[model samples]
Target: MLTPDALGVATASTVKTLKVEAPAARSAGIKVKSVEELVEKLKNEAKVI
Candidate 1:
């Protein structure tokens, strides 16, 4: 995770580049069963909601 200071410096830099990558899906199948379940997990576990 980027610190606040590091994020500020990165934002101020003239050269801007963004890269995003997704991990390969597990062979066991989907982790969360459904969208609602996923949202619930995010809210309860991740506290992202």
Candidate 2:
């Protein structure tokens, strides 16, 4: 398992972006292709990444 802060999450913008789209992120696709699957995708499927 990965630590909560292993990634650069020590900023306000990062936190906002996380919560803003975490409600409905996708499991696969270019929108969120981190492979780590840490970020939650939104339903809209917009280009936030």
Candidate whose lDDT is highest: 1
Root-mean-square deviation of Cα positions for candidate 2 versus the true structure, in angstroms:
17.9
lDDT of 1: 0.80
- Residue pairs whose backbone atoms clash in candidate 1: none
Candidate 1: stretches off by over 4 Å: 1-30
Q: What is the C-alpha RMSD of each candidate to the true structure, in Å?
A: 13.4, 17.9
The lDDT values for all models are 0.80, 0.51
- Look at candidate 1 and tell me the lDDT of residue 26: 72
lDDT for each residue of candidate 1 in 1-49, tens digit (9 for 90 to 100): 8787866655455875687689978767459879999999889988999
TM-score of each: 0.38, 0.15
Stretches of candidate 2 exceeding 4 Å from the true structure: 11-49
* Clashing residue pairs for model 2: 24-41, 24-42, 25-41, 25-42
Cand. 2 Cα-lDDT:
0.51
